[model samples]
Target: MRKWFGQSLRLGLAPDGLALVRTSIWPHERARLLAQARFKENNVEAALREAERMLADHEREGWALRVVLSDELVRLWQVAPPPGAARMADLEAACALRYRALFGASPAGWQVRADWSATRPFLASAVPQALLAQLQQAAAGSGFRLVEVAPQFVAALNQHRSMRRPGAWFGVVHGGVLSVAAFDGALLAAVRTAPIPEGADRDWLEGHVAREALRVGLGRPERLQVCGPAPKAWASSAGRLKFACTLFEDELDPLWPDSARLAMTGRAP
Candidate 1:
């Protein structure tokens, strides 16, 4: 999971805004969106200022925090394992080399995390070190502990990785961004993200799938599973999308639309 136990504050950072959620897994596995605050200005720097204020001292103590940054804030890619790879150094060098190619920048200012592999292509993500430092300082000053910080799509993938199939790709949509992981049989071939277009519908999704498949050098999938706060029209029975589309069934997506009246366990709150 998040490499930790017990409850923690879930901070969702997106371009639209930022949200602070209270998540608990001890007594019950549930999350409630406690508060959302707009940034003073229209950028991530403003969001950081708002977060610093939100974490100011004298109010809360001894809490752990997990900051989930959005796709627009971090970079993600798939790194193929090198041939005859027999050590971790090979994997690290491959990632570092790929980072320069993909980002055209040295990895000095970035902190990288990856699913290391010497036999198959694995996922890699990089986050800005400045962002982490600011959050960590604020949390520590407020008597809170910084437990884990991750990109939103990476977090989602880790949560539902077991559901991934051999041929069908997986996508996570949120805050007008779609993060896709395209696979070739059992190997992860590509990882990419695209912004959701305005007034997007089933037709748009078909086009998206076709384009992503071509870009990743894969055949069109017969079916795909997607999750997030997607449009309801995507689920319409009539004039269905070309491919078989299935909602990535999750505990929260089941009750997300009208969760106010129902609990995470399908009982009245």
Candidate 2:
């Protein structure tokens, strides 16, 4: 008795290139590929053209569009409210001041999204306004409504929320950038991202993971789940840690972001 509606388009924009996927949640076909294309990041004109072409071809008047940008362009921060900040506006100002102090620049023209609670403070991601405007324009031009735009790590985290385990380490590697997140079953403890050196050895990755875990006061994880383009040898390395490790075997492709976004939302589009 599931009712499916309009088609959805998901796009991933990364430093290397842009990727697109289209899917529908109709009962007869819950999900199927419509069209996909890629373009190098340096060539903005070409990338825009490809996006427009794909959008024009598959978009219906009211279809939904979602976009995920590469983690490289997003800056994630964990902030606490300033002392005596009682109002939401005051808290936001405190966060902005802290951000300026940390990054040495004003956050003007940046879209800052936050997940916060009174006890936990804030976990926020700041993305450039120009990038969002570009995506918005593309969606509007294509006759589709842009519903969500987030960083890849955020989308991936949302996609795998159900799989998180207490005292576990989860890592996502995409485009040579590795994003590590730790959970304590109830709360997300830490998140960090770093670039993997070219031709990195197993020892290098293991050391990095251990260091990050320690930084987050995790000591060591009971389990590890890695997604995206990780080396095959990582399994043996992880085994040496005396912890359960799983490497997602699916090849990293353009469609992955779309799939993850869909998994996170559970919406037809």
Provide the overall lDDT of each model, using Cα atoms, as 2-decimal numbers: 0.72, 0.68
Candidate 1 lDDT by residue in tens digits, 190-247: 9878888999988888898899999888888766767676666665366564667666
Judged by whole-model lDDT over C-alpha atoms, candidate 1 comes out at 0.72
RMSD of each: 5.3, 4.2
- What are the TM-scores, per candidate, against the unseen true structure? 0.84, 0.79
Can you write out model 2's per-residue Cα lDDT over 44-100, one digit (the tens) per residue? 556556667777777667777887776766787767766666677876787688779
Regions of model 1 farther than 4 Å from truth: 1-6, 26-30, 236-241, 249-269
